[model samples]
Target: MELTINVDETTRNGSLLFKAARTNDTGAMKKLLESSDVDPFIRGNLEETILHTALLNDNKDVMEVIVEMVPSLINEPMTSEMYKGETPLHIAILKQDINMVHYLLQHGADPIHARAIGSCFIPGPYGQCYYGEYVLSFAACLENEEIVTLLLKHGAPLQAQDSLGNTVLHVLVLQPDKEMACFMYDIVTSFVTNKQKHKVQSIENSNGYTPLKLAAAEGDTQMFNYLVQKQKRTYWTMGTISYCVYDLTHIDTWGDHKSVLDIITSSKKMQVRKLVDIRPVKELLHHKWKTFGLKYFMLWMISYIAYTSIFTAVCLYRPLKRMPDNQTDNFTVMIQKTLAESYRTKGDYIRLSGELFTIVGAVVILASEVPYLARIGPRNFFGNASIGGPFPLLMVAFSFSIFIAVIFRLLGMEQESIPLSVALIIGWCNTIYFARGFRMLGQFSIMIQKIIFGDLLQWCCLLFISIIAFSSALYILFQTLDLTNYPYFRDFQMTLYTAVELMMGLIDFPIPYNNVTPSFIYIVYVLYMIFAYLLMLNLLIAMMDDTYWRVAQEREELWKVQIAATILLLEKRIPKFLRHRSGVPGITLGFNDDDKWYFGVEEIIPEEKGKIQAGGIHMAKSVGWEVIRSNLARIANMKEYTESTPF
Candidate 1:
């Protein structure tokens, strides 16, 4: 007899209308809807409406009654935190109830504007696979083409993006399996007009990832290929001379100034094969080199030359400190040198100028490292001790060496020679960093780097241990025998040198029948030779060979990574205005209508056209403006003739 549903009672067992809808009880639902006290808009558990409960129960008759009597409740969404923003239509799609979905759509259930902003739809722990906010986006995420079609038929916009700015295509690309994404891509693109399709595909999410770039970033090569194939062409091909034009904006830099090269190279999930082998990316890199990379690379080379030249000149021109005869009195010489007031006579302008330049150069070089340290972070720059890489640290070391030499020179000490020698060695060795500009040199440098860091480092450790073990044993054994006869084993220092000489075959075997020398010493020497020369040396060769082969496989990727880092670093150093002026712009090919290629403009040299095909190899030599204009004119005329003549 009490028609009004209590809130507590509703929380426990849902409202009377919701209960009736759950059972598909048509008569009880009719009585509930008729009762003025029973509000049709009341929500039960999870703040689900009567329509949502009906759809959950598949109560078709109850849903039909509620739609007619309480039309306002049709689009009413769940108010519960997790399930909020989910209307009856969104629920029906989730339920996979086609008839109910259609019936709700026929009435007033909105499919286009209705968005589900529930916790489950958002990108978080609640749901790893974000279905997006819009109803159509949800259907596309489910991979239900039929339900998606139904939503589209009811005026659901494919161009509509969710709260995250991801369209249906963007969501599809995020799915683990890209097959459904490709299928949905074709379906969705077909559903929209040409203009709308472009907008839908190119729409960037909050992270600046267009669906295509997202696929590339995700390493979904199949999905990326599909998207590329679909969008790379603006029109159908015709005639014998068909042309293919590419959209640079689709493949090049997008979202946060990241290039296609940047995305693939920096992605931890992307395989090295994908980074080096992808055709478009390879082309993009080539375009970059031709456009701005060559100039920047040359500038870096000039800077390096200037840098190394300054240090080399300083070390060469630095005046040597004169010492007195009877240099054997090293303590007296050191004391004399320490007491000397002036390093230079103050008359040697050459030494003075050299020291001044050296100081300036060292300071300049040290200051230059600040940019690199800031970019890579001081932690990584100084922390990484790979002798082959860490270009910044190498420069830092070189600068400090010069500084040490300069300080010693100022103090009238000969100690500057040691640091000067070190600085020269490091400065020249650092030239390998510039070798990345050339492919062959870059590969060779990487191989050498791998060998030194990998095989050679381990070999040095083993060699050191072998020398220490053998030298110590030989010293102890031969220490008791020698009275200046065999000076090689007279002490630990001499014995250690002897161990090295023996390994190098400098010392002959079998000491001239000295009975005082323990027979056990010969046994130790033999074992040392066998372990060090026979086993360890061969093992070192094998390890080097293995490292060489391994590096050969990854040669291109490593080289490209080096080059990419250089290119990015160079870009950062350029003044923002000049850099923007040199920025890659949208290139519009004259023959390819008005669709601009936002990547790079390619030019073919007219004089080089004959040389384009030589020795059975067709080289795509895009160079000079004349060739591009010539090709464009020929293609345009051919297209015009083909169109006028008809099939």
Candidate 2:
């Protein structure tokens, strides 16, 4: 009869072979492997290999013993559901056991191809393992240069990507260790050939982030600079005139068609603060605006002018109306009178032309918004008021008003003028949208809009409350007085009107001495002035001043955000054939053989090429880099090179 050997629950599920492996009991492991019932390769509940179980207890001797008994277990992977595809080498590197790692590599362990894709490596809510899924990546993440060098020496492929398509360099940026990232970046660049380096640098991960682009998204400036420096090739350096060609594909859009700019300029994520504060990104945008943005903006402006002018002409040249004879004329008779008078008027040709053009303009403006609505999604298009400015909202109102006015005019309703007046006001105000084309005017326009919506809106709320309070108090105080004594305060409506007029400095003293006490009336008048004019008005001025300085500081960045939005919107309107007709901005960076659709080149003088560390991140300062892009030859003679400089 066989009696069960009761073991501690801690000893790997009480399996004798696993227990022997964990405790470094080579004799027990040998006896267990020899048993017909016990298989050395049998996986327990967690599916850990015997080698894996020995490594867990740092039992290199047990690992060697097991390997000698069943040499196949040396490279055997953990076939468990949770830790599938994890090899002994991957376990050694993760354990940071350099001796074990050496032993595994010496025994012909597959370092490059064997990916550890266990539950431990997958990112999730509880915690994340940011390292790529390979032994080389695991060693690099640990920053154990000895193990990394050993793995590389043992012929680990430098260009290998893990389960998420992230190369070791891509994984380094996502880690919080900047020094390790920089050190590994230097190592990778030095070890690889130029062609291999470009492949490693430009290959985007599953989330569409290259190593450099990932650094930008992670806001790791030091790592970003180190990566940027590695990719740059000094084309010609003659004293002060040095032209270094950067790989435009470094910052180019990834497989998802999302560029570095798209990630950094996201308002919802507030990533502008993360990366746009860097100098190269700013110059890149400035270069893009100069190259193709100015022309598109001018076209949008000219179209807007025509749109507004047509609507204005329609209102200005409306047919003249004759007054109805009696004030109490029936609605049908009034409509007939208005139609007859409008038909009898001269200048019918001008009126008809204006009306036709106005209809076309309103329809065009309404239709143009559909693209913007679709591109940004309804939440962002409506929520982010700064992007579209007030123009989108005003255009919508103006279009609706124009449609209503046109319908009323056709129906012979005299109220057509009411909606027309609203459209005319909104149409003129909508011109502020074009102000963004000019730098100074654009920032100033943003400031004014900010003040109106922020400070002025709050002031209006306070003003309303004060008015209602004072108006009620004064109405009750002056109720017994006759109209002859205090006509402005005799009724509740009149009292409210008088209160508003007093606030505006449009009314004089109107306190009556008949019913209300002179002192109380005087006190009320003084209190109204103090609360509404002195306090509220002055507070509004101070609030505006605060908003002005605040907006002034961020005006340039704010203006650039609007410009980015403009570029995205304008590109949507351009026909793809015409957009790609000139080989200007688009070029093939030979890394992946894919043409970069959005990119720019930065030119920097050698004297100003030194890197500046900003908030512990390296960036360029002092007119860092002036970005320029045109035909490939004019920017850089080589099609393979795309440049981004220090600043």
Residue pairs clashing, model 2: 246-642, 246-643, 247-642, 248-642
Candidate 2 on 501-534: residue-level lDDT in tens? 8888886876554564656767888999989978
Which lDDT values do the candidates have, in the order given?
0.68, 0.69
- Model number with the top lDDT: 2
User: Candidate 2: where are CA atoms >4 Å away?
Assistant: 1-22, 36-50, 70-87, 105-125, 145-165, 189-202, 250-257, 267-284, 295-299, 327-346, 382-401, 407-422, 447-549, 564-568, 571-647
Against the hidden true structure, what lDDT does model 2 obtain?
Answer: 0.69
Please, what is the TM-score per model? 0.65, 0.68
Cα lDDT tens digits, model 1, 1-647, are: 24454655544343567679989999988887787657777778689888888888888898899899989888898888888898988878878778887888889788878888878778877863477788887777777788889888888987778888888888888776678777877776778776677777777888778888888887777777677656443221223222344555655442236555556545545252364445545655664565567788988788778767866875665554456676646554332234244344664566557567767877887887866676555545522222125667878898898888767766767566789899999889888777888888888776766677667887899899989998898888876775476766767887888788788777675366645666797799899989877888789889988888887887777777666656655655655544422212222333222343432223232232122231111113322345444544533322221111110
Model 2, total clashes = 4
- Which number leads on TM-score? 2
Q: Which 10-residue span in candidate 2 carries the lowest summed lDDT?
A: 614-623
